[model samples]
Target: MIFCIKLPGGLIKWCRVINFKESASGENPGNLKTPSCFLPSSKEPVRFNLYTDFIPLQKIVTNPNLSL
Candidate 1:
């Protein structure tokens, strides 16, 4: 799965790929945060849209041979 985050006022000057770490243990599982993908402005409002080919989570997680 890929996320398409939209930024207001052309704030997305650059983006950095990051990997999020899963939570250790709690009601919230498999939650993680990526290092901030810096924007050009701090006051801009941003929106995110996630996209995927509708591949099953099992296929996405299990297939090490697949290339993004």
Candidate 2:
């Protein structure tokens, strides 16, 4: 699933599905298994707010036929 986050200035950022896995027995309830990156640019440094909370697959479905 892809997650689109809206920034303060109405800019939308997209996060692709890099990798995923089911939680282990002792793992945290809502943790992402993959590490995400910020887009590089010529401007000053960009800081992003990361959310580890797992959103349901139904919420971010831009295309239902596309594979994660």
Residues 1-68 of candidate 2 have per-residue lDDT tens digits of 45565656677866543332223332543544433333343134233323444444775696577554
Any runs in candidate 1 off by more than 4 Å, and if so which?
1-5, 10-13, 18-34, 44-56, 59-68
- On TM-score, the leading prediction is 2
| Count of clashes, each model | 0, 0
| Sliding window of 10 residues with minimal summed lDDT for model 1 | 17-26
RMSD of 1: 8.6
Clashing pairs in 1: none
lDDT of 1 by residue, 22-53 (tens): 22233334333322233334466332212232
- For candidate 1, the lDDT comes to 0.40
